[model samples]
Target: MVVLVQKLLGHFVRSEAYCLVNGKDLPRLDINSPAIWKASVEVGADTEAAMSNWEPAEKRAFRLGARNFYLKATGYLLARLPFQNMTLRSLRCLSPNAREEESSGSELRCLDMKLPQVIQPGDISMLMDEYTVFQLDTLESAENIDECWRAAFDLKKCDGTTKYPILSKLVKAVLIIPHGNADVERGFSENRRLLQDRARLTLESFNGIRHVVCYGERFDSDPSSFTVTPEVLKVVRNSKKRYSERLALQKEQSAKRPREEPEAVPNSEGQDLQKEVETAKKMLTNAELLIAHGLKTNDLAEVESGNSLLASGKSRLEMAIQKMAGSKNSLPANDLSVHF
Candidate 1:
């Protein structure tokens, strides 16, 4: 029972990318190895030979099971491990490409889209060239990913600056990725504590407190141990000034924006009808004035225009009154009608 458990566990432990890259004590497992079937080398001649002793049906079942396990485990690891995908494994570990004929084609295209800033389109060729040299340099020296990146960063040009600036940045970004969510969980806990007692905190205030907490935690410093240097005093003094400036800038930006006219409130049917009545009254008064002017000057055109205006005003007034009456008729009988 112990031997069976160890054999299974050995494969799982060896499957880890970190263990492989770091050259951990556990030897890499081969599916064909007889040791996989039995704990000790003395137990079997080979996997196939040992399987020959079993029933034909058992042999077929074991092969099928192994095939399925390999496929499923490979897929699961590809998602979590960087540079361990079938195409990408060649980049970091110098693993032979599955398709060596197509090796000349862009391998960067298959890169996980997690680092857009680090891997720009124009720098693709340069990045590949740097990675080529990086592989050769770390062929034996690199014990782990951290050392590999440190070596990459150590590569200097004529001016003593990093040879592969972009690649170095990419490596740094990748290495900084946390293996677990412990830090994230802790951050959520801290945020929860800050928000207790129905506390009302502004975004700026929350961020400031978060920054202070992070700074103290990172340096392992107590609040009392913090030094109040001249720079700190200056920053403190100018804080209000900076705040005022920010407010002024915000106001200026708001003033520059095009003002949108307020939406006109929709009038109810009753209100619309009332407005129409008022408009008709105004039109009638204008028509009467025109008629009076025509009578005084004896102009036929003016008199004709006044008559047309008067007809239009009368029609509008009648329509509005009819609509108002219709609306009233649509309403249900009130309780007062029961008394009647």
Candidate 2:
């Protein structure tokens, strides 16, 4: 246990920290407090020696760190005190603005609603006094504050309940503070995105763009669906000074785009292809007749059909003229042939 104590004190003898209570002289912290433990261990050497002669800046930093530590340790409880007190005052139609109670230190700061223009001054002195007594009584006697608040909130603001107006105003002020900052931050971000890198934007032009982007954000998935109306264009033209002949010019350009063009057709090459098709048709007919003649051997009726075709006075070989009337020297080395 002595070795453990020595080990911890070895660390704590560094920081300058002690305790204060009841406005009395400072007291050295318990060894359980790490700051004092380390200071004690390192004393009479670097730690305690430095405390005997603290530089101005070092002293400032030490005090600041101590203040921060004190705040962290006790701030949550202190913060709740005012909030609870204000809520209690609000619950009984007693305004926090009505009080000017002497307050000192950061922890006990009270509301300063002195300007009549700010709170619209009124006389609710009796209500304030009654509220204090009621709150004090409730603190001692009421069980389950959550239920008490619910009952208080349920109190209707009829002709008899004079407290409701004051309570409602207080509730509005208290409830909106935390949420209000988020709205302010959102507005700041919107301004940043709008105003950055936009050197040409005057206040008037910026107002127009603000309206455009806000209303047009709904069409963000397909921004082309958002047509600039005449009014919108007018605003831009009035700001930009180019509104007159452009609308007519834009309409003319838009109208000319959808006119149909004449389809392209090649007259010369098309005629040659047409002639080739007709020649292929004639050859195919002659070839079909020759094939049908070969089929006649199996069917005599087909042969009769062939004989009728042959009566056209054009024998199949005569159509080809394969035996050119010339000697072997006159014959061409290659002959025309069709591949399957």
Candidate 3:
């Protein structure tokens, strides 16, 4: 069990990104590492030995042997920790027998049983100084009420033997009626109600229900604080709107553009057309070269080259027209000689 607990602790430490243990961040340790195994073994051995010595016997020669053993073991465990001090005498006086004392003799015996020293108001005051007190109401006819009252009164006694009065000094401790799994049964009832056949539940639905039960008030009271802001919504809406408008404009432009038919080349004009094509190609080439050089020098020479190319292509078209007019006598080629 100790090994299992230690392994679980290690697993939890690794799974939680923000968790710290013993004032240090968790180190990366193999689950089956030798050091972890050794620590688990040591802890298990110590716990087992303590439990074995502390285990209650079914029958004993001494009247309070089992009780005394329990008290001693508890005291040993408590003393090892950085908390309250405990002793055997204080333990016995807190037992059921001590409270039934009806005479002075029995009272003196109870006082005598208080070992080491008796606790006093100063002790109680010191404990109260560090702790808070809560009052609970109970039924007058409740079972074991007398026993409870006796225990509470005995706790106030300062005598060290039977009573140490440390209860008064305790920072905090809870006391309640003895009930057999009532709270557990109530929780099961609530679970059943949430998971009934009428609910048609999935894992998500169950989780939602659980969250509501745990933090519904906080959620319902201030939903905006836990939800996305209006500014975020506005940004999302604007981005989507801009994207849709850009797509629509592209579609409109595509619809408006006219498609041109492929033109055939005429054998009579082929030489002149070829010359024009060559001149256009050279202009394009020069423009690309200029663009490259301009890019290297971070200048606008490429833009000027492109404009000059356009002007040169226009001039070449005018020269081709004049040549055609000047050579009107040279017979025009038939349409059949033209090839697309």
Candidate 4:
């Protein structure tokens, strides 16, 4: 039974391409082959019918079909399945030809005309341990019929390691490509400019801006006539209402608070009074000292004038006094002797 199954599986795996090209259904190899036919009959009419429809050529076709089906199914299933106990060694047993093709890829060159190179088992194992192990394992095991397969596998593994799971899933499931938030942020920037322009716009006009900015699609026949939606207007109105309410609350609270007159600070009267008293005391002491010394007001005036003397004018004053004395001498000794 195992031998038959193995033979069937082998035939299907080998002729997958032929089956797809011909668009023929798979034929049952075990149906007519007495050993498996009895088991098919025991299973039911559907099984029997399926088995009876089997032709040897169709069997080949079915094997081919099965191979094609397995290729796609395994690729998808492996995407979700765990990769425990999975390695190049186990994968080699499942797909010997795939292993050989990967290892001996000198014939198949890349776009750069360089021979395809295989990654080291250690590297592959490390990648598996770090990222989506099952995905990498499946990809490594899957037949590399095209460059896209390797590219997709490598991208998935790399993305899994670098990005958060939710983001990675979004990349795979939604965009089907890895992209940063920069794209979304750019959309927001463009939308904001359109929505908050100097020219007043309705909600519909804003929606138009959003669509054009985010999706890069024109909304109306006349692009100028594009507009936003009611939903956007509702959001804007709610935000404005909330802001106004907050402002009103602040104003009310301010109004409710008690008003108080500003208090006046005293001038420096104490310092002024002290300074005046000291000036009075100094004048009285000066008067008493003048009386005690019998120094007249004229003497006091002379002392004040002397205190006002300039160093530069002192020589000129001395010269003027000498000149006066010389003029008196010039009057003659006889006129001077007559004077008292």
lDDT of 3 by residue, 1-340 (tens): 2233334343222334223332111223333233432222222455446556553552232324433443344335333532222222233333334333333223333433332133353454433322222122221332353455444544432554423235432211112211247754554455545533222232233334544543534566476655444754554455556666767988999889897775776556645554554554454454455446545543332334334443554455456545655664343443113211
What lDDT score is found at residue 304 in candidate 4? 27
Each prediction's RMSD over C-alphas, in Å, is 26.0, 36.6, 33.1, 43.8
lDDT of 4 at 277: 34
Quote the positional error of residue 331 for candidate 4 in Å.
83
Give every collision pair in model 4. 12-63, 26-62, 203-228, 203-229, 204-227, 204-228, 205-227, 205-228, 206-228, 207-228
All candidates: TM-score: 0.36, 0.26, 0.16, 0.19
By lDDT, rank the candidates, best first: 1, 2, 3, 4
Model 2 Cα displacement at 278 (Å)?
A: 82
Backbone clashes under 3 angstroms, per model: 0, 5, 14, 10
Off by over 4 Å in 4: 1-173, 176-178, 181-223, 260-340
The better candidate by TM-score, 1 or 3, is: 1
Q: Tens-digit lDDT track for model 2 on 1-340? A: 2223233333433334432221111212243343443322222355546666888787667655644454343334333334334322333232232222322111111221311222334634433443444344322223454444445555554566644344334434444433356755554455446644332343345456656665676688367788778886777667665333545677899898987786666455434334333343344354345446446433322233233333322333233333333223222323323221
lDDT of 4 by residue, 1-340 (tens): 2223333334324334223421111222222232321111122356447867687786566545555564454334334433332221232322324433433222111111210123233343343333343233333443543342334435444546642233222223322222357754454345334423122332233334444443324453454655666754565566566666767988999889898776666345443333333333333333344333323432322222222222112333344334535442232223222110
Evaluate all candidate structures by whole-model CA lDDT and list the values in order. 0.52, 0.41, 0.40, 0.36
lDDT of 3: 0.40
Tell me the lDDT of model 4 at 189: 49
Q: In model 3, what lDDT does residue 10 have?
A: 38
Worst 10 residues of 2 by lDDT: 103-112
